[model samples]
Structures are given as C-alpha cells and as structure tokens.
Target chain A: MVESLSLPKDLVLGSAILTVTGNSDLYIENYKGILLYEDCCILLQTKTCQVQIEGCNLSIDYYNNEDMRISGCIRQIVWK
Target chain B: MNRIIIWLKGYVKVRLSGFSPERFMNLCGNRSIHVWGVENHGRFYILYMSRKSFLQLRPVIRKTKTKVAIIEKYGLPFFMHRYRKRKLFFAGILVFLMILLVMSLYIWDIRISGNYSKTSDMILKLLSDNNYKYGMRKSKVDCEAIEKLIRAEYNDVTWASARIDGTCLIVELKENEILRQEETVEKPSDLIAEREGEVVAIVTRAGSPKVRKGDMVSANQILVSGAVPVLDDFKTLVGMQYVKADADIYLKTRLPYEYSLPFLHTEKEYTGKKRYDGSISLFSKNLKFHIFDNPFPEFDRVEDTKQIRLSEYFTLPVTVTLRTTSEYRTVKKKYTKEEAAALCKENLKKFLDDLEEKGVQIIENDVKIGIVGENCLAKGMVDVILLMEKRQDTEMVTVTVPEDNRETEE
Candidate 1:
C-alpha cells in the first residue's frame, strides 16, 4: 500500500535502521554522514533525520560507506 | 572479526596539527576511505586508520592545508616491512611452516578402545608390529589391513576397525565371548589330585569317592572314579556305565618359605655436585653434545625432555633432552635386628596374602627369624588347606548285554 504512493522507501518509510543496546552500543545502518564527533556527544546524518547521540566516552567503533557503530555510555538520543 | 582483517591490512596513527583537523577526516570519508579511532591531542588531533586510506589522504591533506605526520605504524604488513631486509627471518618462518605441513601428514598419536581384558599397550604393540605405529604417514597406513591383522593375531578379537581421526590413529576391537563354549560339553572323566596333600573333605557330586578323609594322596592320584560298575543278581559284574566326574576335594598342604634380610646396607648419598648434558633428537636421530660421561660412577642422572607439539594429538619428531647427573658418595648404614625382623615380617605377610587369593585356607604358620652372620634369615613352613582337582576325559564305552544274562536277572 505504501508503494502505491510512489514515495521513496528511504525517505518516506524510514530506510535507516538504528539499534541502541543497553545504552552502550549504537548500530546505525543506511547512515548518510557524520555531522559531528566528540567524546561526550555524536551527531549522525541519516536518510530522514539527523541523529544526535549524547553519551560519555563516545567513540565510533567502526564506520563504512553506509553503516556505522558507536559505543559508549549513551544517556539520550535526539532526532532532528 | 572484521577488525582483525583491518589490523592485518595495517593501520597508521597520524597526527594532524594544522587548523580544522576534522576537515581532514571528513575529506577522507568523502573519498570512500574508511577512518576510525579519532582522538584530540593538545592542539593536534590523532586519527588511526588503515594504511590504504592513509595513502589516499594526500589529496585531502593538501586541500585542508593540514600538517600530517605518521606517529606510529602497526599491523602485519608493517611488521613484515621491518624484517624485509633480514633474509634469515623469513627463511626461518618458511622452514617452520614447511615442517608443520610435513608433520601434519603423519600420524602423531595412536588410541585404542573397546578392550576389556586386553591391555592398550598390548594392542598398540600388535599395531606397531604391522607398520601402524605413531609418526607413520597416514597415506601409507592401510586401515583395512590393520583391522584384519588385529583380528588374525588375537583370537579374542572378533571384530576390529582402524581409522585415522585428524592426526591420531583410532583402533577399536570387539572381543569374542563365545570362544569358550567348546569346552562346556560333558564327557566321561575322572577327578585326580593335582598336588600332594592329605584329604580334608570330599564332596562328590557325580562320581564315586576313591579316597576317604585323612587319606594321604599323591599328585596324579585319582580322587573320584567316573566308572559305575553294573552288577547282576549273583553279584557278577556285567558292564560298566561311565559318566563325567564332578567333585570338590579339600586338602591340607604345607608350603615352605625362606627370606633373608641384610643387616648392613650400602646406600648412595648425594654430594651436591652435578654435571649437565644436552642433546637434540630429530626424526629418531640424536645429535648429542658430549660434555660429560653418560653414566657417572656413584651418581644418578635425571633426564628431562620436551617434544615439539602442534596440538593435543599432533607432535613432531623433534625433542630436546637435558640430563643432569648428580654425584653421590657411598654410605654404609646398619639396620637393627628388630628392624630386619619387621621387614621380613612385612614380606611374609604379602606372601600369605598371595596364597589366600589362590583359595588356600591357612591352618598354621610357624615362622622364625634368626641372625645368620650379617644377614637375618626367616625360615618357616605354612600349613594350608585347599581344594585340588584335575580332570582326565575318556570316551564312554557301550556294552551289549546277552539275552541269557537278562533272563537270569529276571
């Protein structure tokens, strides 16, 4: 039914998959870019919105063309 | 797991001291070059990324006008680069790998299972006699031949199988339980005395008693007769009926025991001086460095050896042996008469225990210890009661009765 609307899935149906486990591991799939990187906070760009991750000792464990993993003590996540 | 691949591909710790070092990272990411482990270092920033991505960062470094310098290089590629000029290092690694590859093709261990009364060593010896020992090449070992050889060599083994499992040779055997059935058929036999003894008791189950109680019997004497003589009405013997003899005969016997214990003992005492010898064994060949005599006079040698093993079941035929010979001096020690007597008593107890295990009931033991010269002699006679039986099989004879004799009996 959503395909009948002729809207791109990544833009209209949330193509980005974000998994946060136990406030320690954050896995993001289909991410666009890293807007900001810091020890206490990280801002990532996804398909539909910008993701702001606030944490302590935040570090990007790995990053590739479309996927990224951030690991730290994550306290909150804000999507803009 | 992916990180290990990245590490093997090599990585570099680069310090960017110029303005906006983050731009350098962004530019690297834009060019499809993966970068991770970003850290701030004073006015500079340190980024650890793969070597491939670092090589591709030259254009981005010029664009950002950042000063880039490699602080450290890590991973396998860089490690190899350091040893590139040393030819011996690579040669050693190649030789080691070659040896490992060659050793893995041979059997390093042999394991046997499914044995009840047969020992593992005995089975292993049987295998070794047929070119199936450890360190034999797996390609040369014939599992079927080994199985057939084991079955033919041991009558107890009914079924056998030999196979190679990884670097170990596994052998399994099933023993024949029905091999003892041929001796169970009853035949005409007589129970005879196996040893000289006085008759203690007689319990005849299927035979006539040949000797009564307290009768002195010699070896090979018939204790029970299997023949039953048939008689006529006039007390005339007509024929004989023979059957298998079955009886338990208990006898009283005497066994002599003699043991001697020395009073003066010469023992070796360590003098705290030692000599060492070392050797290398490769493929059953020993390369020894002659530093001292192999066997030192008045000295004991302790040997320690280590073999090269790749896994639990895979071992190479290379061993290093270290032998340490410690010097000693002869010391004369004197044992008290009581101590010698106690030692003799301990030995006699063990002998008595052995006799009891063989179903001999001890009736009386008279042992005496005496000091003869520098030695203590224990002389005695043990009286034991035991059951002795020896069977001789005979064919049953058929006898025909005449019609006149049958009519006379009627």
Candidate 2:
C-alpha cells in the first residue's frame, strides 16, 4: 500500500541510509551502533544488517545519536 | 559556526586504551554524549568530546573496560585558565576599549562645505564663538539649532544644514551669488574722488553728476551727489530728495614706482650635506619632544608634521614631525649690465600685470633702468585708468514748499 502511494522506502521502513559525497566523504544516518574502528576500516550495525566501510586514513568528522559523518580517501562500502 | 560553539563550550581530546573502544563510543552515543573527530592508532582510539560529556564518561568507560586519559585540552576554558596569571594584560585591553568608547561619545572633527562668498574660517570662528567646537559632547549638539544659528549669523547663506556623523560634525551651506544687492538699498551718500586725477569716464547708476569728463578733480571732491533737486511746474527748485549714490567713475592717474637692487648680493647655495631627524608632539597638550643634532655651522631645517588619525574624521592629538637639515654657504654674486636691465624689465611687467589683475587698466609705462655704482635703480611712473569707489554721507536739507507744488515723481 505504501509503494502504491509512492511513499519513500527509507522513511517508511526505517532503514539505515548511506550518503556518499564525491569520493572523499560519507554520511551514515539511522545507524544502530559503531561496531569496530580502525585506520583502514570502520564497521557499523544498522537496522537490517551490518555495514562495513574500507578506507585509508578514515576518521569520523562528527557523530551524534542518529547520524555520523566520515571523511577520508574511501575505497569501498559493503552491506551484509 | 557549530565548531566555534563547541570550542567556546570547551572540549578535550581523549585517548582510550584497552579492549572494545568501539563499545565505549557506542555507550557514549547511547548516553547522548556528543563526540567528534575520532581516530584510531591500532593500540588505542582517540576522540574529541565536550567538557561536560567527558565528566559523564565514568559509566561508559567502566562498562567497556577501557582506560581513558585526556591527551590534549582545547578551547576557551583552557585558554583562560592558562593565562590566569597575566591579569594586567587582559585589563589593559579592556581599558583601551573603554577609552575608545568614551572618545567616540564626543566630537573630534568639524567640517564645513559649500561656501564661496563667505570663507570657511569666518564660519568656523562663528561656530567657536557660539560654543560649538571640537571635543564637545555629541548628544548636546542639536543639528537643527546649529542650522538655524548659521543661517541667522550669515546674511548671504541661503540654505544651511548641520549633521553629526560618527564623531564628525558636518555643516553644509549655500550662499547668495548676488552679493552686491546691498549697495542699491544703502544709506544716502555722495560719491567722492578717491585720488587726484582727471575724469576719463563716468556712468551714473543712481546719483546726480557733479563732475564731467576731462574735469580735473582733487582728492575728496564730490564726483556725484546723492541729493536731487525737485523742480516745480515753473522749473524752479521746490525741495530736495535723497537716494543712495551709486556710479562707476573711471580716473586717469599716474602711479609712481621705484625699485632698487644691489648689484652685489649674497645668496645661499646648498652644500649637498643633509641631516634627517624626527620628533613627536602632542599639539592638544602643547608637548613636543625632539631627537636631533646638527654639526654644520649653517643649515636650513625643514620640518614636516603629520597628525595621527584613524580616518579623515577620527583625528587624534599626536603628531609626528620629520625634520630635514641641509647645510648651505653664502656667496657674493655680481650682476652684468644686461642681466640687471632684464631683471628690472621683468619686475616692471609683473607690477603692471598685478595692476591689470586688480581691474586697473594700464594705459602707459615710462620706466627707466640705470645702474648707479653698486646698485641697479628702476624709476618710472605708470598711467592707470582705475574705477574708484568712495562715498560720503549726504547732508539732509530743510525746504518750504506750497501744498500744490508737492507733486512727487520717482
């Protein structure tokens, strides 16, 4: 019914969102928690699955309860 | 802006050592602790959090079994704490700002514009006489009142306006271009000869003619009379009427000119030796301090002074003067005959040009230059046709006339 009404899936289903800006920065929204932090990789648990981000010199620019912004030379992002 | 706010609130860079640093961050996120700029060094994790959040991190650190230590403290709280011992420097900055604020409350500069017939010095003198001058409190100055005062004091000023803009008092003025209208409505007077000369031309604008062309008149002789004799039907003098006398009377006169120049004169010549020095002066307080030394026997000191000002209108009392002293020696110079004659002719031409500039027509020049002994003398008379303005009060007369003969024609 929501799909027939053309409602946005991210807002209706409450799924985690990953926004990439160019090749330098990434913004993650509605994430559950930070799972692991390292210089080359960062893992996060979202509502549906675990999200992993692999990068060089990866650092969190800012983070609050609902969202986090990461900035570095990003290599890849995977969801499992 | 958010970063500035965080810096203002103060923050600390914390280093977490032990297991599960990620859990520590997750616990901090759940507890509503704001953290940012997180980096990892394999053995420990480093992150930044607000000073208040760091105080509430005991439970999160204990839960994750991570030992945390503040590696670096940042922001305003730490800055103020570090400079807590140098209280005088901070106090000096506050006092300087207070002085600037106080100074802005009073006027420092006054500027007058758009005046041609009346000089700016005249208007400035009037303003100072009426207690409106530099250093006066700005609130006490009423712009409308100043406008009214300026218009009332100056008869030629047609429009006047005064305003205060950022410690500067500006006065704008417009003057009447018809400046000679007062002569037509002036008191009854007679036009007299200002110099002993033969009358060349006369144009009567208001008065009755007392002298004609080619009439030789002495100084103080009446050239035109303000009184007019009224005639009756029989062409007999009945009474006299008075009006202001105005006329253009040109006089042909001889102006005696004599100039003497010494053939041998002492002139100072520069020796190319110069000394540069400076001084600081407080003109408002009449205090001057100079640092200079001149070893030359004879020198000319040229000093240039400049006032300290933040802008055109925000001038201060401090002045800096740079003094330049150039050494010189006097030498005796002898003039040749041709040089003396040429110099004499140039001076005579300059004199004639000056007379022409003053509206005096140069009719003829009969100057002769002769070098006598050690001096060059130029003596001659210049014929000039000059219009003179001189007046005397007309005498009031009493006359008896018949009632029927009292017909007035103006």
Candidate 3:
C-alpha cells in the first residue's frame, strides 16, 4: 500500500538515512544490517543501497537497529 | 542538558578482541542493546555501550568467543557503585546539608536602618532582651511586638517596624527629633506679608482675605487676617472674634546677582591611557594588591564603591571596589569673550532654574554681559513672584481702668 501511494521509500518505509558531520562523525538511521567491519573500513546495508565508510580509525560511537553514530577520521563514504 | 541525560544512563568503554567482533555487536543490537563509540585498533574493536547492555553481553561474548575488558566507566551508576563502600562519608554530607537548611530557617544577621540620635547597639540590645535575638526562628518572630517594645523603650521613635528579609532581621525606625513641643499649643494666628511687594495672587482657604490680587501690600501687612468683627442689625459696633487664617499669597519681588568669569581657564585634556584597579573590601577596610606603578604624573581618578549584599537588606562585610583612573595633561584654555559670556549665562540659567523650582515665577529679567578688562562680568536682575508666609502667636491683653476713669469714659 505504501509503494502504491508512490512516496519516497526512506520517508514512507523508514529506509536508511545517512548523515555525515565534518570528517569525524558519521550517523546512519534505519539500517538493515552490517556486512563488513574492519579497523579502517565499515560496510552498512540499507534497504536500497550499501553504505561504505572508509576512515583511518573508524569506530562506532553507538549503534542500534534504528540509528547508529560512527566517529573517527573519515576519509570517504560511498553509496552503492 | 544532553550531558546530564548521558550521565544518568551509565556507560562503559569496552575493548573486544575476537575473530568477528562486529557479529557480536550485531547480536547485541538484535537483543536491544544500544552500543556506541566503536574504534578500530588493529584486530581489536573498542566500543562504548551502556552499563546495562554490558552486563547482558555474556551470551554474545560466549557465542563469538571474544575477550571483553572494560576500558573506562562513565555516568552516575558507576559513581554510586564506586562510592558504595563509603557509607559514613555520604551520611556526613547529608547531615551537613540538613544542618545548613535548618540554620537558614533562623535569623543569621540583623540590620538596622533609619535610626538617628539613638545608636543601633541600643536597639539591638532592646531586641535581644525581648526574645528577638539572632538565631531565633523567623516563624517565631513577633514583628508587631518587637516594634512596639522598641518604640516604648526609646520614646523618641515615632514609628518602628521589624521584618525578616531572607536570613537577616531588618529593623526600620523613624525618630521624632522635635518631641511634640509648643507646636501642639494651638493659637489663633493670621498670615501676614514677610516683605513689602505687590500681590500677584491670593488663595484663602480660611479666615478673611485682607489683600486682593494686584494689591500693593506693605511689610508685615496682614494678607489674611484672623480678627473677624461680629455685628448685629442697625450696623452697631460689635464684638471681635478671632480665627486661624490660612492662605497662599504670591508676591512680585526683584532679585539681583552679579558674577565675574575669567577668560583663561585651566582644563584637563585626556591622553587616553587608562588604568583600572580592583580591591576586595572587608569591614570597611580595602585590601588591594597592585604590581604596577602610576605611569603618568597628572591624571584624573574616579572612585566608586558598592556594598556587596547577600540578599535584600542583608549586606555582607565583603565588597568589591573598582577604581578607574585616566591620565590627562593639564592645559590652559583661552576662551573668547563670547565663550566666557556663554559660560556666565549658563551659570545664571542654573540659578534661575533653582529659583523656579522653589515656586518662584519669573516675570521679567534684565541681564547684561560685557568684557571688563580680561574678565567677563555678568550682571542680572530678575523679577520673581512667590508666596511668603510669616506668623507669630501672641496673647490678647485686656486693658482695665480705675473706677474714676471708667466713670468718666461712661
């Protein structure tokens, strides 16, 4: 029914919303799962795309099912 | 505000050394455990999670075969846990707070205001003897009783009031300096002119008005006379009755003044170097510590002092005093005759303003300013009108004659 109304998935279906502040703070909302996690890289799976965050010292400030806050010296973020 | 919320919810930083720490974190997330502050250090994953979630991570740790070590603990729960052993110390703090609260309910200080002739110590002693001393509970203070007691003991206090202001007891008093003298002896009086002048206006509220508007009155003339003649039919001579005459009479009079001002004046011109000195004053003594010397020979100093009050009507002994000084060079300023005359006119205007404030109406002003040698001389004469009242109490004397003289007059 939501898809028939033709509303944005992120707004109607509560899909993933990613926000980055400066080069040190990264926040993700409505994420589905985490695929790859390492010292310098983190991979987050959303309903529609994959969020690849590459940083020097990537660390998760906080993470739950609804929202997550990642803090480190972020070098790049890619959506695929 | 956010920090307070975070402090209430205890958190801890944990270092996880396992094959797949992210999987362990995901399991924890699935179980509704909120995790934060994840950092990568080689193979070990450092993360922060709430203290509640950290305790519930045993199953996840076992499943992932990870080594968990708490790096740091944060928030109030941990604080309470750390100080749980010091039960006596916490009890001592609680007792101290209770004592402070209880002490604040009583009077800690007393202040007196509006007192003259009678010393404050006498009033304090009077209050202490009447059970209104310091440390007395504010709720127990009988304000009306204390005021009455002070008034009765002093006899000179016209009015008195005692009130509790914060932690201080404030005693307000008004002293009667005149002590109700011969003024209470009422006598029939008349309002008379103090000096000779033309009457401008007359408003009589009591008795008969002897003078009208624009009437030229003489010195010591009765403007409102107290003596009123009571007569019967046929216009015969009758008895004289007296009354207290009250009236407002405005008179037209002239006031003259002369002033001389020098053309050259000495004025201080600021050089823009300013210094501020601050001191803490305790009990009227200023304690100042300064490491710098006065760099200028000539300067202007302005001192301002304010008392530090703990509450309204409760001033503490300590005060912060701040003084600012500006360096200036004294220079001789040469003024033109017009400028000097302007200065003199300003002075004259100020004098006239003062007179106007005292109910004087300026009718005409004849003023002249001119250069007399190097100084400017200003001469002015202002005609002003104001109400003047003067009266004296006198006993009415009766004249008695001898029997032969009385018979002859009859």
Q: Which model scores highest in TM-score? A: 1
Mind sharing the TM-score for model 2?
Answer: 0.55
**Which residue pairs clash within candidate 3?**
A59-B38, A59-B39, A60-B37, A60-B38, A61-B36, A61-B37, A62-B35, A62-B36, A62-B37
lDDT of 1 at B23: 63
Candidate 2 lDDT tens digits, B318-341: 678888999999989988888888
What number of backbone clashes does candidate 3 have, counting pairs of residues 3 or more apart or in separate chains?
9
| Candidate 1 per-residue lDDT over residues B1-410, each given as its tens digit | 98799779999988877876656666676688877766654576677888988888878878889998899999999999998999999999999999788888998778899987689999888888776777888899899999889888888788999888767888999887666354455667998887788998999998778999999999888888788778777666688878788888998888889999899998789989889888998877899985897555788888999987777667767888999999998999998989998989999999999989987899999988889999999999999998876788754567777778888669
Task: Assign candidate 3 its CAPRI class.
Answer: medium
DockQ result, candidate 3: 0.53
Worst 10 residues of 3 chain B by lDDT: B393-402
Off by over 4 Å in 2: A1-80, B1-102, B113-133, B139-160, B172-185, B273-283, B293-303, B322-327, B395-410
Best by DockQ: 2
Interface RMSD of 1: 2.5
Whole-model lDDT for model 1 versus the true structure?
0.83
User: TM-score for all predictions?
Assistant: 0.64, 0.55, 0.55
Task: Give candidate 3's chain B TM-score.
Answer: 0.61
Error of 2 at B143 (Å): 3.8
| Full-model lDDT, candidate 2 | 0.87
